[model samples]
Every structure is written in C-alpha cells, then in structure tokens.
Target: MRASRFFALRERGTDARTEALGGLATFLTMSYIVFVNPAILSSAGLPFDAVAVATALAAGGFTIIMGLTTNLPFALASGLGINAVVAFDIILGRKVSPDVGMACIVLEGLLAVVLVLAGMREAVVRAVPTSLKLAIGVGIGLFIALVGLRDGGIVVNDPSTGIALGDLSTGPALIALAGILVALGCAAANVRGAILIGIATSTVLGLVFGVLDGPSAVARWPTSGDFSTIGDGLAPGALRDALTWALVPIIFSLFMTDFFDTVGTAYAVTSAGGLLDERGEIPKVRNLLLVDSAAAAGGGAMGVSSVTTYVESGAGVAEGARTGLASVVTGLLFALTIFFVPLIAVVGQGVTVGKDTTLHPAIAPALVMVGYLMIQLVREIEWDRPEDAVPAFLTIAGIPLTFSISAGIGLGVFGYVVTMIARGRVREIHPIMWMLVPMFVAFFASNWLSAHVF
Candidate 1:
C-alpha cells in the first residue's frame, strides 16, 4: 500500500482509542496542578475549597472554549508561575489580600479579551520576532526548572553555611527526586504518560517507605462540595482595590508573562505534537486568545486567581490529541473529578512532605539544561556582526535574571532598533516596536522608584 493510504487506514483503525488515551493522559498530567494550586493558595489564607472548585470549573470552561473555537489540540488550566506569584509575591510578599490579587487577575483577563476582540493580539504577536519567542520559551523552561529544584529539596538556602549540599541523602526527598528523574528520562526517551507515571510511582514509593504521611500531604481529588460551591470566596471590595494603584504592576506582570508563556507553550507543544505547519503558526490564534481570556475571567469569578494555557498540554498533544475533541474530553474529566476531591486531597497530602519542606531535586539539572540549550541557540544566531547577535542574546538571557518577561522582550526590541539604526536598516523596523521601549523603561523605572522611594 502507498504510504498515505497505509497511514490513513492506521488512523482510522486507532482514532477513537488514541483520542480516549489522549484525554486521559491530559487529565492525569494536569490534575495535580488543578488540585494542588488551590490548596496551596487556600492554605495561605484564601478559601481552599472555593479555589479548588473555581479552578476546575474555569479550567474546564476554557479548555472547552479552546477546543471549540481554535480546533487546535491543546488544554487550558491555571498557570503554575502566575499562581506562585499571586500566592507568594502579590498576596504575602506585598501583603495584599487574595481578593485584591484575584481582582488584578480579572483585570488582566478583561484586557486579554479586549485585545482578542480588537484583533490586536495577532498584530502584537506578528510584531514580535520569532527569535524573541524562542528566547522566552527557553527562559521560561529555565525558570520552571529552577522552581522544581527548589521545590524538590535539591537546592537549599544557606547564608552562613555558604552553599552546602542539600539533604539528598535523606529518604523522602531522595525518593521523590529519583522518581522525577526517572520520569523525565523516560519522557526524553519518548515514553508516554511520563509525568503521571512518575508522580504515581513516587507517591506509592513514598507511602511504602513512610515518606508519605498525614492528611495534608495528599491533595483532595474533588467532591460534591467542589462542584456545588464554585463562587464562594469572591470579594467585590477586592475588585475595587485592583482598580487602584496597587494593581498597576500586577496587571502588567500578568499580561506580559501570560502572553509570552502562552505563545511559547503553543509553539513548543505544537511542534512536539507535529501539529504546526511549515510557517510555525498555530491555526486560529484569535480563538485561542479568546478562550484564554474567557478562562481567566471565569477563574476570577469562581474565586481563583489567573487561568492561562498549560505547557503540559504539550503532553496531551504528544499523545496524539489533534482537535477540540481532545480538549472537550479533558474538560469533562475535570468536571467529573469534582466528586473525588477527598481522594485527591488524601493523595496530595499523604505522599508529600510538609508544604514548607516539599522540594523537587531535578530543578537544578533542568535549569542547567535549559540555560545551555538557550545559550547554544543564541550562539547559532550570527553575532559576529554585532548588529545581528547582541540584541538577541540580551533578550534571551535577561528575562530570568531580571524576573520580568516584558523587560526581556523590551530589551530585545530596543536592541533591534539600535541594530537597525546602526546598520542603516531603520526603515525595515516598525514604529510600534520602538514604542515598546519607552513603555518598558517607564514601567521598570516606576517599579524601581516604588520599591526605593516608598
């Protein structure tokens, strides 16, 4: 049989099975975040159970939106970094209320919706260079790896002790680290369900060795309470606070980070899943942005913080999820999990370390790998002619170090302008790109002044 004909037959033979497997895999991979983030935020004083229900509902709604509108094979959920930012940085670090923090998230969602409706997202995206997108992707990867390492107990903070080895020699931490490593290795080797398999195995081993203990360790899966109380903790006054000066930085941060993260994630996952065409555009960008915006808004109403696209959706795509059907399936599963919150909670609490102590050891290695990969990619760009290389490198490396994606993107845009001017190729660049420079500078300077002056 001809190759196309043979593949067609094969696709027909396994389409239903593949899709079912894809949906299940997607659920397993994301359920942890769906369950854990709310718990974490709630423990920090937000309504724990309310956040849980809201997260699931918002995620399901948005995933369905993405599937129906975009026809792209991807899933949506609460973002990992954004949640940490909301819970730790905005809420605790700045001493802001969770209500106010969520308000900012709502504002961002509104802004995103406006951008999508105005057709501005596509324009803004086109204005950004492809190299910059890649840089953002690599930077996020490094940042994520760093977070994992810190979480897994592989890295420790010691000022007086001065960088001593962490307790990798200990049992619970060691086992978790080992399990993560094995799963990551398997993922690299193209193993299916790598993350789910890793977490499950680690949890079981933790239970077996007494590493897993107590009720707070495992996450409650979902329950009737999870579904029935979606909008339990909203504070209208908090929304008003978000409308004030306190929300300015939060809004900017949310928009910049979510925009780049979503873009980079789509690119990486689509490529991995063989979904992108020759030009690297995921079809229906407009629809994707709309769903993302809607999801964030939904999350806000449901009493959670921000909801954005999941990079882990790549896992689903890798498993051969090809259409909205996959996302719909994923959404339904999330809705169904409402009844199993107790099981999720037990699992989350039982097999994990104390919230203060739980760590992921692979973070350092992952960061190192991402950094190396980024450097390698940057070097391949022709920098020997200073005009070609300096800006790109600055853009690539500056994000994580500065802890601001907008700053990094701004630097890249600024470099592009200077390079164009020096090379006498100024006309090729757009006026709007130059506009970003002053905006970024103003934002950064204001933030600096706020920190120092206030």
Candidate 2:
C-alpha cells in the first residue's frame, strides 16, 4: 500500500483507516492547546494572537517533522506546565521582561538541542529505570486528569477547602457530568472513537440544553503572528539581563522542567501506542528527541514557549495508530486550524465563568478516559521490590501532587537512590543517577527560595 510504504503501517500492525481515525482522535483530544497556550503566555505580556499563531505553527510544523523524519506516531506542541513557568516564574516572579523570559526558554531549548546532538540526551533517557518510566506515564496521566476534572467543572476550588465538588446545578457542571457518562458508556461498550463520540455528543447537548452559548457563525482565518521578539531573546544584552548570578537556579529550573516534561510525555504517549521495542525503548528515539528539541528551539524562534511532545497523542495510539500517518493527520489538522480559528474559538472556549472555565466537559471526557488507559501501566510494574515500587509510587504520585513532571521524576529518582543506599545496594545506581540527585534538589530549593525569600 502507498500508505504502508510511507508510514510502514503494515509492518507496525495498523491500516490506513485506523491511523487516520487515530490522528483525528488525537487532534480532537488536544486541539484545546491552540487556545489555552496562547491564553497563558499572554499573561506574561506576550501577544495572544502571535502566541496562538506561533503555537499552531510550532505544533503543526514539528509534529509533521516527527511523522516524516522519524516515522513515529508522536505529536509535539506548546507544553502546559512550561508555559506556566515561563509566565509565572520567569516573567512575573522574577520581574523579567518578556523578551528576557523568552531568552531563558531559548537557552533551555538550545541546551536540549546540544544534549540530543551530543547523544547526552539518549544516555540520560537510557539511564532511567523502566519502572520509573512507566511511573512517569501514570503520573502524567493523573496530572492531566486533575486538569480535566477542573476544566470539566466536576471539581472546583473552595476558599474554605482547597478543592471540592463543583456546583452540580450549574449548566456546565451538569453537561460535564453528562459528557463523562457518555464517554464512559461508549468505552464500556467497546466502541471505537468512543471518546470523540462522547465529546461530540456532549457538545450538542451543551448547545441544546443551554449549557454553552453558540457562536453566531463558526469559521474564519486567524490573524497573522508577530515574530517581533523571536530571536531577540538570546542576544548578548538579553543574555546578560537574563543571567544574574542569582538566576542560575532559575535557568537550571527552566532546563530541568523542559527536559523531563518532554521525557515524561514522550514516554507516556509512546508506551500507550505500543511503540516500544522489546527493550522498552521507543524506536528512532534519537530522532524523536532531536525533533523534540528542535521543536522547542524553533518555538522560541517563532515567538512562543517550549514545544514538546503532547501526551494527548495517547488518544491516537489508543485508537489504533501505530505509524506516522496519524501524526501527519494531527499536524494537518493543526495547520487547518489556522483558518478555522473562529470556529475553534467558539466551540472550544469550554465554559468560562469569572476566569474559572470548566474543561469543555465535552472534551474532558477524553482525557479522563485516556488517563484511565495510561494508568494501566501500574499493573505492569513489579510491586514487590521496595526499591522499585517505592520510587515508582513516588514518581506517580508526585507528578499530580507537585504539578510538575520533572519534580515527580526527581522525587522518584531521589527516593530510589536513597532507598538503595540505605539498603547497601548503591553500587547498582547509574553514575548519571548520582548527578541527578543534586540537580533535582537544586530545582526544588531554588523554587522554594525564590518563593519564600526573594
């Protein structure tokens, strides 16, 4: 098949229709980023339209590259946690200019590129234990789940209590619950596209039940992006401004967050796709990593935050995508979104309420279901070994609790190493593992100090 030769679908055990559906599924699951990433970055004084354009271009362009070059099913885009860091910590917290913040992101991306090109990235990826990798996948699953729940209005914040059940009487909350039920029902019935179907159904119900206010019209082209601040970030003056002695910790924090967030997303999505080889390594991993780092660097140049692999690609993998064709479809959808921004803006606005929007409960169901699927990795872990199980559990728990992928890995790795040392099995640890302990501690300490002292 022409498709078979291009994406090797036959060899990988998928067909054209299945891969196409998978791509559509993945796009539906993740297209929210087009709006969300721009919204978050705008808080840091970046232009919303420009960030939106850059986000779409970076996501679409590099995801296509990932498909074509690596022939893998992974997709890349502006990351969630990193955007918060760029906005809150790098820009707002440090009182840095937006350009300087972009400088930090650019430097972080360039460092990733150097590491990948030098094979240091692969070395680090290989050094991580399999159990911990699976744990990262599960951890990210719950993190996104928490996000989905918040967005769906199933969960809400209480000034009295940290978080509590949302108001059930609200139209959005009820629609979210209905959407969740539809998705869960479809999955239980073994229906293909169950998640997508649920999203569509919930959207229609949201419209009919007065839960969502409809747009007057659905489609229009997006505004062109402003690349005015693109490469200005890494200029000599900008670097000098960004690199105070006190900010060493800030830079390291950026690098660490970008590095492991990609690692976690890549691990989770690839594992979901069954793209791992017998050794539990994603094939063409070096290519994938290079493409990922290149995407981050390119996003910086294109005027956005860090771009990394999207974990929502698991939606595609769950739908039977086993080749790059799915990624191609996803990239194409992102490209088309440039013209359909008006339509997406209407439908995907979710349920906005006083700056507290519900996860367009329409799509939140997909994430909840995907998280359920990814969490199944827990069963594959060797539970009897305390050294392995403890670290694994910590990693899994930490991802959601800390709301940072790198922090979870750091916690898990630290726990693993300390447990081994206590048990007199320290010799088994990788040398790089030793290097990581202090790095993780530094990331935590730096953030704490910045929050408490400075």
Candidate 3:
C-alpha cells in the first residue's frame, strides 16, 4: 500500500510485480550503455574507470529521480549522439581540453533549464521545421555508423580515396562483422537486449582470437581515482574556456538535440504506455523536462555527457510497466553495474592492429546497431518537396561526411530559409528561425571570427 501510494501504482493500473518485470525489461534493453558509454568517452582521453563510474552514477541517479519526481517509467542515461559530439567534435575536433568540452555540456544543460523555466523550450522546438529535426536524428545515425565502421576496422583512411574498405580478414574486423550479423539476427527475431548480447558475443570472439585481453579482476569496489572526473567541468578556467564566442553555437547545437530528444522520447514512451493525459500530451511534462534538464548538467558535472530520457523505456511499458516504480528498479540495476568495472573494461579496451590503427571489435557492433535504430526516422521525412528534401538531404550527408553535427544542422537551417524565401514563403519562417540564420552564419565562420573579429 505504501508503494502503491508513493508511485500511484493502482491509479496507473499497475502492481509491484508488474513494475518489477517492466523495470527489468527496460534495464535489459538499455544496459549496454554501461559498457558503451565508457568505451566512447574514454576515446576523448577521459579515464576509462572514471567515465564508467560516472556513467552508471548519472544513469542510476537521474533515472531514480525521474521515477520519483514525475512518476513516469522513463529512464535516463548518457545520450548516444550527445556523447559522440562531446568526445569527437568538441574535444578532439576543436582540440579543446576535456574539461572545457564538458563545461560546454554543463552550459548547454543550464541553458535548457533556463529555457524550460521561461517556457521557451517549446518555442525553440517549433522554430525548427519537423523535417529538419527528423533529419538531424538520421544524420547523426549515419555519423555514428561511420564511427562504428571505422572503429571496427571495416573502414579505414586511404591515401587516395580518403577512406576505403579495411582488411576484413583481420581478427577484429572478422569479429565485428560476425557481431553485426548476430545483432541483426537477434533483432529480426525480436530479441530483447540484442545489442548487448552482440557485444558479449563479439567480446568472446575477440578473446578466443587473442585480440582482446581478459579482465584482471571480476569485481571490486571502485576507488577515489575512479571518480576523479566528478566536477571536472567546474574546475577553474573550464567554464570560461567553454563560453568563448566560437563555442556558443556548439553549445546551442547540444541544447537543441537534448531539448528535442526529451520531447520526442517522452511523448513516444508515454503514448505507448497509455500514460498520456486527456489532451494527449505527457502528464507532468514540466517535471519531466526539469529532471531531464538537470540530468544533462549533472552528467557533465560528473564528466560523462548530456543525460536524457531514453525511448527504450517503451520496452518496459511493453512489459506492463505503467508507473515510476519501474524506473526506480531500472536505476537500481544501473547502480549495481558499478561493481563489474573489470568486465566492462575488458570489452571496452581497444585492440591495436598497427601503430595507428586500433580496433574495438567488441563495442563497434553496438554503435552500428544503435545507428541502425536511429536511422529508422528517415522514413518520416517527405522527399517529394524539394524545399524539405534538399535541406534534409544536405543535413543527412553533411553530418557523417563533414564530421560535424552542428554543421549539418546549420546547413539544413540555412537551406530551409533560403528555399522558403525563394518560394515567397518568408513570413512562414519563425522569428527564432530567422535568429538562427545569423548564428549559424557565425558558426560557419567561427574560425575566421575568432581570428579577426574577436
């Protein structure tokens, strides 16, 4: 009764046993993040153990908060595309320190919180056309798939062609290919946690082929050094460095992704769970947004990345989880993963085939699999209208080809405005969209502005 009172389980037409099963289902569907997040973030030069710990802490803590505050079955974790931006785009591409890159995430999260408080988050979302928003997800999916291919050694840099097919005969490549097949097979069979299962299978193949080293320890309590990334974004000078003119658009880009992602995930998951209000909107949306916004900042402060609601919560909903009790269960599972750091380390470690070529056979397939999942949004875009199609195409191609999510979004925005003006539909463009034009122009010329104007 106390549990029912706290989570309003009976009102939601759910019981404790159903909530527990739903929580387990959701956790199984998403537990791959525990291995994948650290694998991705560690490439940015963050400590592997630290990121692993931070990732679990953020996911567990935020998901529990989401359950308690909003009484929804939504779960939170370090977002996939957002982490890629923080790791590759901000830190490696821009050549900024990890602290500065993470500080950008913090700023973006805080800005989102401000926008939500001011009731302007929806305004910003409406400013961008639906086609462009959908295209952003598709573009990022290609970008992620590209990264996965490169990491798995199925694709490699070429002297003449820029990139070419890699040596599939290699152990890592073979394992990756096999892993992808296994994942796809499982998915086709409606397997739960297919991606996680693929990673495990690939890791085993890697071990058998001697391409991966086994874990030194099975489990242990993490030490202080394992959490050194905590609060790194707030260290002196990090936030200052992140606030530069050149980085502002990058932060805005992150905010846009996080903002739209939460809205979309919340709507989809709640709708599936029959948890929508009479108006067909998410119940307690403000509370949900607040928790998601705070999680983004919390993830950055913990040195992971932006944390957001996962669409995979639908898996729990499918299992009869209609209340936040399921979320609390998911959070507890994530918390339990902290002790299995050694097993995580084994799968996350990269295998070097050459002086410059490192392969992640165990983890690469999951990236490719996730990309496949995200890319499914492509069907929602209308291709017949050139105005929408052209901009969407530019965005879809720009992200993976140019290696910049923001650049792709800017291209799409610029093209959308230009095409609308060409069609004499200028008045249809939102004032916020108009504001974005100059900002994107500035973003495109940021290096020049930083050099001459600033």
- RMSD after CA superposition, every candidate: 5.2, 3.7, 2.4
Deviating ranges (above 4 Å) for candidate 1: 1-16, 47-49, 160-165, 214-234, 271-280, 350-392, 403-411, 415-424, 448-454
lDDT of 3 at 231: 99
After best superposition, candidate 2 residue 242: deviation in angstroms?
4.0
lDDT of 3 by residue, 254-286 (tens): 986787667656765786688889976678887
- lDDT value for candidate 2? 0.76
Q: lDDT of each structure?
A: 0.64, 0.76, 0.86
- The best candidate by TM-score is 3
Worst 10 residues of 3 by lDDT: 121-130
Q: Sort by TM-score, best first: what order? A: 3, 2, 1
| Model 3 alpha-carbon miss at residue 198, Å | 0.5
Residue 306 accuracy (lDDT) in model 3:
94
Q: Cα deviation of 288 in candidate 2 (Å)?
A: 1.2
**Highest lDDT, which number?**
3
lDDT score for candidate 3 against the true structure: 0.86
